[model samples]
Target: MEYITLNNGLKMPIVGTGTNTYGKENNDYNGEVKNEIPELVSALELGYRSIDAAISYRNEELVGRVLAESTVPREELFITTKIPANEEYISSKEATRAAIDNSLKNFRTDYLDLLLIHHPIEDKEQLKNTWEVFEEYYEAGKLKAIGVSNFGKNQLDDLKKFAKVKPAVNQIQINLKEPNKELLAILEEEGITPVAWGPMKTEAHQQEALDEIGKSYKKYGAQVLLKYQIQRGVVVIPKSHNRENQAANIDLFDFELSAEDVEKVENL
Candidate 1:
């Protein structure tokens, strides 16, 4: 797998697995948490070392159990989890610290590879308190990295006001449907990596074009789409239940998209 160097000199995998719906009944995001997540096991078996999880997903213990029990050593896995912006989590510095400690326990790890604020905290004091807590953990060596998700430019600017450590990445939706061109440029300018969630969303026409482009490389449209994102320095966490699709998602290092084809995808 490819890697991107963060501003803090840490390396993150360019591709990872999104586990928002894993370990849930009927694979539903809001379903009850089950004891096992066969998909996560399959993903690890297929050479996926990066696992993206969140507290709001409500399956942290299961996902953490699978990771802790996997043959892959703890040092090799890149585990990322988010703390929600709700009052229960960010109401006070102590509250945020408790949430982080709980997440670490749920993951069965001493340190997280990355932690993020699930959403922007509207209250300035709450935002400052939450971020300061994150900074505390980061300094204490409990969190390897800290960042934010679904934040617009204004929120990011607000964060910059008193942030001691700049965000390493901004997790956002980036696909042909919602390219987020302007924000992406801003992230690029700021030296912050952009992690794309829901990366496979695209129109039928776009998929047809990607298929045509992939024909020569013997790849699928999904592969081409992911390649487009990573080729442009964006990290993509594309989730799939099918084992074959899981393997295909990580099988992205063999071929390179030509500049002309890349431009075509950009225009799409």
Candidate 2:
């Protein structure tokens, strides 16, 4: 597996298994509520070293289960979770610390590989305060790296102006349809790697484009999308329940997309 070095010098896997299947209307069983423990365990066994979960996802405990049971060592895996976006949660430093503690407990890990602010919302001051707490934990060696999610350029600028530790990553929606070049450039300029969530836009709106690209590549639409992001130097976390697809997703290093091919697919 390929890795990206964060600003804090933490190496994160370029591809990961994202555990965001909460309240997903399409899935028969919700990951958080129904417990997709088996799939998570399978992902680990399949050589996935990074698992992205969140306090809002409510599946951290299940991920913890797989971590504890898997043969993989704790040091070999990269576990990431986010603080909830609730106003009350962000308003208090104590609340933020408690939230991190809860996540550590849920994941059954002594330290987090990464922790991101879930979203840019409500009180800005409170959010900055929350970041300070994260920095404290980082200094104490509890958090290896800290970052933000769904933050635009303005929000990123705001954080940078007062932030003690620059964000190591900006996790955002980046797919063929929503390339988001502006935000990505800003992140790159700031030495922040952009982690692509929803690299495969599973929604109906993007299905046609994904299919077209997939046809050209003679691969699954999801795989095409994931490859696109990785070639762009963005970390991608594409989730799937099917064991075959999960394994196939990581089998990207064997091939390279040509410049023209990249442009053709990205233009769509």
Candidate 3:
């Protein structure tokens, strides 16, 4: 798998499987969904070494259980989980520590590869405090990297203004439909890698172009779209329940889209 060295000196896979689907339909606490475990097993067997999860997803314990049971060693996998942005428990340092500890216990591990703020809270001061707590966790070795999610350009700038330790990555909706060039430029300037949550998201009207371009490489439209994001230096964690699709999504590094083809998708 291809890797990008984050500003914090940690290596992240360019393509990984996102576990959002596991908790989307299930609300039962302390239980694992039927397909979730098998899907994760299949993805791991298919060579996906990175797994993205969130406490908001409600399946961290299940994902952790599966990983604990898997034959893959802990060092071979990179796990990421986010603290729920709207939770009341994040306002104070003690509460934030408790929240992180709960996620750590859920994962059945002592440390996480990355931790992110699930979304931007309204109050700037509150957001800054939340980030400071993340910094605390990072310094304590509970988190390898810390970042923000769904933050606007202005919000990111504001966070960087007061942050003693800057964000390492920014997770956001960065698909072919909305690349957010200005925000991407800011992330680049700050040395933060852009992590795309739904890189394959595309409108029906834009299908033909993706298909037309993908056909030349014997790749499908979805592959073409994800490839486009990777070409732009963005990390992608695509959600898929099917094993074949999971396996196919990570097969991106094998091909390189030409500059003309890359521009074609950019203008679409």
Instruction: Compute each candidate's TM-score over C-alphas.
Output: 0.99, 0.91, 0.93
Judge candidate 1 at residue 47 and give its lDDT: 93
lDDT of 1 by residue, 1-268 (tens): 8899999988999999999999888889999998899999999999999899999999999999999998999989999999999999999999999999999999999999999999999999999999999999999999999999999999999999999999999999999999999999999999899999999999999999999999999999999999999999999999988899999999999999999999999999
The pairs that clash in candidate 3 are none
lDDT score, residue 244, model 1? 100
Order of the predicted models by lDDT, top scorer first? 1, 3, 2
Model 1 scores a TM of 0.99
Question: For model 2, where is the 10-residue window of minimal lDDT?
Answer: 23-32
**True-structure Cα RMSD, model 1:** 0.6
Which one is best on lDDT? 1
lDDT (10s digit) by residue, model 3, range 1-268? 9998999899999888888766434534344555347778889899998899998777788899988889999888899998887656577777788889998998888899999988887787778778888888899998999988888888887897889888888999998678788889988988999999878888996778898999999998899999988887899999787877887798888899999998899889
- Candidate 3 has its poorest 10 consecutive residues by lDDT at 23-32
Q: Rate the local accuracy (lDDT) of all candidates.
A: 0.95, 0.83, 0.85
Residue pairs in candidate 2 whose N, alpha carbon or C atoms collide under 3 angstroms: none
